[model samples]
Target: MGRWVLVAVAPAELVLIALLAAGVEVPAGVRATLGLLMIAVLLVEAGRWSRGYRRGRRRGLGRRAAATVAAAELVPPPVTTALRWEARVWTGLVRGLGRRPDIPPGAAAFTHHRAMRAVRWTFVGVLVVEVAAVHLLVPAGALRVTLLLVGLYSLVWVVGYVLGAGPVRPHLVTADRVVLRCGLTTRIEVPLAALADARPVRRSRDRTASRQLAGRTLHLVDNGGTSLDLDLRSAVTVPLPRGRSAEVDALRVWVDDAQAMARQVRAAAGIGPGAPAELPPGR
Candidate 1:
């Protein structure tokens, strides 16, 4: 906890130092934005604390979600394991029947873990609330119809986002390439030769890379998605799981094991520590 506190404070401290050195006052807009964000967080927490939150417009959806989660917990571990087995079988059946484009079936096994479930469910939950708001708040007739249409678009967006960028879906890593399966539409791969390195990061490194890359990085820091950053051989355009393709200099992905993954990838790609680029501890 102490280390985490230091990590959290480091960035703010750096900003303050830089501003002081430069003899510049903080911008009014920046201060206002920060203040507003703090207030928003406080209000959200207050709402969460109140019993009224449970009885809000999203109450029905909340109850259903809670029930489902509770029922899952009530099942014995062995029973849950058996159910997961069934789920895998069904998943395989669906994959076979759906006839989507996929990577070659070879030495590359399905090492991809399911993306964070909490984040996915939260996205769905927010969309449900938006849909409810559209129906209740918007006046009926053309405007309501239009707003409901907007709500439908939001549904599609949430589904696509959950399927693509948000969740850590199945990924395939082999001696030849790394295949990332993003929902139904995207199957992104980088040749082994193109992968410079793979490094696992905790909060500190995650923040470091995010700061270095800025807009280039794709991750869910607060909500907790995987943050295994991969440096590519060159800048390339890759499709985002949820939206349009963007040319990125590097890629950040979630993997189950960072050390083993980095080792295998380096061995496969024939990269060595002799290279000028310094990789953090695992690399």
Candidate 2:
């Protein structure tokens, strides 16, 4: 965890270390530019983290609802409730547009379907704007053809998001296995029989490994922080981002109410409670 945290801040750390080493040799202007760039990166990452918190709070209504699990403390209950409403609206859209995917029986779904609505709508806006431009701005030329292709790609992007996110089948927490989906491509399944221990991960924890692994991890999180860590009894086969699979035993996930999840998994798998289940620090 410490290593990943350091990794997340490495860019600025390396730059500052280099600046200190260079001292009088480096131009003052260059030093200032590097400093500003580092600051900007830090600021951007911080904003992203905060936004994820907001998105989380806005995800579900009740405390047990998926969104509130991780974000229960980040925002006011009222605000969080409002955010949940926002997420519900997206789910509504998904249902209205097509048949809602059959969720697993006796399971719960943890999703950012509401948070993803913006992207889905953004793609729609792009498709509309680009198609309008193809006909209105460019009249019968190479540029028009280019614009047409761009418009088609925009349509494709919207279709992809809808097809990927609209399905309710991917995010399921059942008595036996846990399935987490990212878009359409990445899917992770953790079965009870092969399980060992589940631990709560602090939200403040850095996501260096999570970022590096990205879609390959069983991440159902809006924030890229560690909310839960699962230690496998043995290596399990899971799908990676690019139509591939990897055998992994140590799986990190960002989800709501990680403590509750940890408890649930431990209980279901017959693992003793109060045992140290945390992943090795900096691993």
Which of the numbered candidates is closest to the native, going by highest lDDT?
2
Q: Write the per-residue lDDT of candidate 1 for residues 1-283, one digit (tens) a residue.
A: 3223333444555665555555668877775665565555545444443433344425554765655544444344555655654554444434434533234556343333343566567878888898998899887765576678779876765554444332324566776887755443345677886777776664333352211233654442322445566777765567652246676656765555655666666667787855534433433
Give a tens-digit lDDT track for model 2, residues 1-283.
3223334455555756654654525667766776676676656656655565566657644434544343343344455545554554456346546766647668766543553466667878877876887778777755566567767765755554565554443456788887766544356778887777878775543443332344334444544465677777766887654345667766776655667777777777778886654444443
Residue runs of model 2 more than 4 Å from their true location after superposition: 1-96, 112-120, 140-153, 166-169, 202-222, 241-244, 256-264, 271-273, 276-283
Error of 2 at 135 (Å): 3.3
Give the lowest summed-lDDT range of ten residues in model 1.
204-213
TM-score per model over all chains: 0.40, 0.48
Instruction: List clashing residue pairs in candidate 2.
Output: 1-282, 58-83, 58-84, 69-257
Residue 224, candidate 1: Cα error in Å is: 6.5
Against the unseen true structure, what C-alpha lDDT does each candidate score? 0.55, 0.60
